[model samples]
Target: MDIVFTVLILLLAVSVSGIAIRLLPFSLPLPLVQIAIGAFLAWPALGLHVTFDPDIFMMLFIPPLLFADGWRIPKREFYMARRSILMLALGLVFMTVLAVGYFVHALVPAISLPVAFALAAVLSPTDAVALSGIVGKGKIPGRLMHILEGEALMNDASGLVALKFAIAAAMTGVFSLRDASISFVIIALGGLLVGAAVSWLFSFASTHLLNLNEEGDPAPGVVMTLLIPFAAYLIAERFELSGILAAVAAGMMMNYTSVANAGPASTRIRAGTTWSMIEFVFNGMVFILLGLQFPHILGRALLDAHETSDVQVGLLIGYIAAVAVALYAMRFVWVWLLRWFASRGATKHGVANAVPGLRTATVTTVAGVRGAVTLAGVLSLPEVLKNGAPLPGRDLAIFIASGVILVSLLVAVVTLPFLLHGWRKHKDPHAAEETLARTMAAQAAIRAIDDVHETESADLDESAAAYAADVTARVMDLYRRRLASLDDEQESRDLARRAESLEFTMKLAAMRAERKTLLALRNSRTINDETLNKLMREVDLSETALTARRK
Candidate 1:
């Protein structure tokens, strides 16, 4: 096939597979189908194999995906889970690198400690996105899920930084702790500052120049939002800082609706749709691309190991399993220590959480699944050392890292359902909360309506005033009915469900009635076409609210 056609085919296939996953009531474990497709493509008759360009992969895919994740993570939840996030993101990362480094070196005698440490560093950062299956529904606690997300955001920088130092040590044969420590701090902190600055600049330009609610064209605002992630990554990397962190920082800082303070509903809708598509395509490509490399990695590793008596293929597989187990074992141990300290007197000093138990620890441990960063880091390893000799265990590093990733993913996929079977959480008390929220919104709208009457009707005739009062009265009636339902729930918890359903039905009926009126006015030619279109939009928005409910 022609190269362009081949690319098109691959994209279509991946998209179709994604659609299948969604359409199926019962999906297989995460990434299994994606991997299977790539594996099949590796067949000799297929005559098609995807190749790696690590730089391109990272630059093209990582920013948008990471930024999207950060943007969606609720700010309040992130802050609440800050302590646990820090422990895993930075502290556990340090321990894992140290422990797994030594373990890998012991497991594979030919692998140098520096190279082993580099592999450990690559595998240390969990992919927050990869943990989605594990954190699904009410299986995992919300706080734990948020902490995992927060941790994933920060550890990309920490793990990559550690990998940087390890790689340097392997190349130059000189490891300076003081210099590495100082550089790590500067790189991390600098990335944060750069990210925030870039975010502010984008926000300013989008709000002032682009005018997010352009009505005629929202493309400028959408385009700017797309550019911000890439710009943030490039700026941070240019400064020799942690671009991963910077991209995440930019995303977290951005208000998705920054283009307009309020009401370009279309722009908001467009931005969300665009970003969702981007994330889906980018993430799907990453896994499939990695799977395509399986042939090359395995071939090289086997070829290299086949020469040695002790470095058998079975031994390599065993080593991968061992590494995977050790990775999570270390995490479990760390979580236990944290909780132990928290339960002791450490909670008084605010260093630990006295309530963190086995459940949180288990979830945290399983959620440590390696992701695209691991692949990118490993594949980017230098092919030759400074002396122009073949880099030692470079192929092994890729194989090991890849194995760890698949194993980690597999481990979580197979176990999470069982772990989460007993984990349950009740529905949020949204009845009371949403009732209050809607009341406040209605009150604000009423005030605005009154202000419009005062300003615009004063100079008009009595007819306009009467029309205004009639409109306000109708609106207040709707608000009054909603307010009444707020205090109408039955005392019996079991009957609350039926009452809620009946209440929702009435609300839905009101929305449908408004829609009917809009259509009637349009049919009678009593409303201008433009006015009909605008009013129809308002009715549609109101109906959407009435239809929306927690599953």
Candidate 2:
């Protein structure tokens, strides 16, 4: 009890420090900072000790973290990057396995091919959460960041799938390409079908049976969204299917079916808030847990490292370095190939949005830093081998993986800031300044118009005065919103720009409706031709005013 309390206090202090540092102007890698703090606590004099249970760790951490990532991923952006995302998520994992496995076997002959493959498969999964927590706080482009996030979300399931196969081959002394291929297909396909069906059914029920308005209470809707991924995953896994694929499919389905169908205001905001909290707690716990376990893992590995004969400590380090470098290089190659493929799609449309550019590709490639899932798979390996023998080089493998993680941590912490710094320096600085000025000008213009309307409204007839007051109120509201957004002038300008586009679209639709109504009125002789002509002129003038403003 005392130990638990002490650990909790330590976590609280570290978390507070992390938040405080972030609150400052300068940025640092939050995970690396937390890791350092935990490590410092674990130093002999501080004496922070806690029991480590892998099962407890997974049970407590994995589902919420995975679900939150799945939930928070923007549905639209994910779909936009879906083509490259799928290739990176599925095809890239296979490529990584073969590349890392081939290299490891060729470089380290003492380690059996299957074991090396296990290492490869385990290390292939990247931690998007970790990368985002570290690097994403900076000025990376939204499109590029989304692509990396998409890849991270999907590749997790892919890496796990590969790990399962590699572990099976290592344990059973069997490596059948045909069987593995068939199993992967079946599991992947089956999981997707199950997830899609379940997601569709749930969404349908929520929309139809529930007397839910888009602006109504969101707690129930939020809870339902939280449950879908895990339920989908477990149900599919029970049927001998891919739980990971099921989770992904369910997430995609929820985004496409439920979230997209939701109205823009309260429903979306509520769902976003719920997912945000889940993401925060889950991410905090995962990093803290990872840091806490490191000392114990290192101690155990050191004890067993001395007995390992298959690979020396030096060779293991070399292998880890080689794998890390190879994995990074492979990511660059794969991303380039995917960009080429995605570009073909974009060329068909001739738009920037449809195709990601070179900078986006580079950022995506570098963002793939391996984290928890990799360690999970490596540590999950059997401590004892076949025929009553202890697993050869198991400790060495863990140590190598740890070294790789350390390398990855260092690279992510150091390189991410540089990347962010460079991007911020190059990307749209002046545009923001210009936009801010325009938004302020627009707000001032609106305010002036409102003041004139209110003054004129005083002497008007009741109906005219009420109408003028209503218009004035609306104009004032818009100006107020614009003023509220004045802190970030460029961001406000972007909003105004988008709002202007939406306003144009709405006006166009309204003009068409008005034209139809006027034609009907003329045909019915309810309104005269002169009145129709005047209405047409007013609408045309309104259109011109909007067009001039846009210019």
Best by lDDT: 1
Give me the overall lDDT of model 1: 0.80
lDDT of 2: 0.72
In order, what lDDT does every prediction score? Answer: 0.80, 0.72
Per-model TM-score on C-alpha atoms? 0.86, 0.70
Write model 1 residue lDDT over 1-551, tens digit each, in one string.
Answer: 58787678668767966877787788674466666676677776987777788888878888888888888888888887788788889999888889999999998878889999999999988887777843455466767777878998999899999999999999999999899889999999998888778888987777777766456576777778898889999999998998888889888888544663463877776788799888877777777776677766776677677887555877888888899889889999999888776677666777644666787788778878888889998887888899998878887888989888888888888888787777666565345777678768767777776787678778768888888778778766655554544545544433545566787788888878888888899889988789988888887777665666422
Give the per-residue lDDT digits (tens) of candidate 2, residues 1-551.
89678668655855665686668688667777666666655666766765556445544456557656665677877888887677888888899888888887787776667777878887777787788767654466776777777877777767777777877777778888888888888988898888777778778877776634455676776678778777777788789787666766776676667544664345665677677766665566566656766776665665455578536545555777887898888888888877777678777887665654666666666678777677777887787767777766666667667767768878877776665665544555446877678677877788689679968987999999988888888877766655644545688767765775787789888887988899899999999999999898777767666676555
The runs of at least 3 residues in candidate 1 whose Cα sits more than 4 Å from the true structure, single-residue gaps closed, are 1-3, 22-25, 134-138, 260-263, 299-311, 345-356, 426-435, 454-463, 488-551
Candidate 1: TM-score?
0.86
> What's the residue-level lDDT of 61 in candidate 2?
58
Q: What lDDT does candidate 2 reach at residue 172?
A: 79
